[model samples]
Target: MYFSRLTFNPLVSHQQLAQTLLQDTYREHQALWQLFDTDPNAARDFLYRQVLEQGRIKYYVLSEREPVDRSGMWLVDVPKPYDPKLVEGQRLFFTLRANPVVTVATAEGKKLRHDVVMNAKKQMGFDALPPADRLPLQQIVQDSCVPWLQARAESNGFSLEPEWVTVDGYQQHESFAKQQKRPVRYSTVDFQGILTVTDPVRFRTALFSGIGKAKAFGCGLLLVKRV
Candidate 1:
């Protein structure tokens, strides 16, 4: 074996040190097992955990699982006093999903633009929203659309009243108003646009005309460029 058992301070609290080492070793074993036994998302998450405080305690190779051949008994080999510890847990079996990345950030199906309202509210954490996740999509639209519409109208020289008693009452009749490029004051709850999902498998079948509520699609976000 290329690795040796790391020496621990015998003079210090031996029980505490042993427990720490054992726990650390167990986590490594469990994490490795999950990479194979669970979904790919679990495997991905397992690899990026925060660094252990006791990273110095080296791992020694334990006996690998071998086929029982003709002898119908599972045999456990004794490793030369190694640090690789055992962990106990029910092995979770989950069927992995298809491409879930498209839901979060994609140009197709208006996902990126549509998700902007949700994403911003998640960041801001408004008191009315209360912990962010509880906010409904409809409320987000109301808060966002009003401001954007007002800004859009003002830029073209039309004045939009904040608290309007009626829907259609802001038409200027003078040349002064005509002199400026006043946008037509028309409001609708509909903003329709199509975004492209580059993935053929995702675009052709799973993602279609409208929104769908489906979870557990094997997906995660990656940023190649440093923000």
Candidate 2:
């Protein structure tokens, strides 16, 4: 696998145009698609995360193949081959932006994906509560998102303590696509903390293939480093 960082060229004259293009999620996806536009029929096999620092836009991408800079607008870092050596009982600090959802079956047995945070709010009847009785928003986010990650960790070959992780940045996004009538909708939550590898093999799969959904829209890329 290859890991790469992509950023707008500071020297580019169209800074404002670049910023505008990046603001639209669909446009951003199209721009990034140029890197892997080798096969017209190829399915997406990469995970990315968008980061904003000091008003500058940046993207981190992990893919099965090296990314090429087809557009002159980006300053593409040299793609580095990534193959982390892991061991059972290893601990590492990790950061992830994930689209967390739960599957619920309807009366007719149709399964639907619901945002975990929204689901929690619905289950708690948050909207019906008196203003003074409602829990802090951050508290609700933590309560809902932490367990969602923990449950994923258990099956993904890792373990996390609720107190060790910080969860925030819950946001809902809607982006229009010309090819589709309805807008693409999804929510993102950021998680940062330490995790221990209970099974290296499964952990490696999770790292390479990503965890959770919406991989195409800059979610589910698990970034990790030594503790």
Q: Which candidate is the best by lDDT?
A: 2
- Expressed as tens digits, the lDDT of each residue in 1-227 for candidate 1 is 11122233445475545544344323333333332354433422211111124654332221222111121111222334312221222111111111111135445645442233444465567556656456665665555544543443322222334343122111111111122465322112322111222333332222211112111111111101111
lDDT of each: 0.29, 0.88
**In model 1, what are the clashing residue pairs, if there are any?**
107-195, 107-196, 108-195, 108-196
Model 2 lDDT tens row, 114-223: 99988989999999999999999889889999999998997899999678899999999987755788898999999999999999999999999899988878888999
Candidate 2 residue pairs that clash: none
- Model 1 RMSD vs true structure: 24.2
Candidate 1 Cα lDDT to native: 0.29
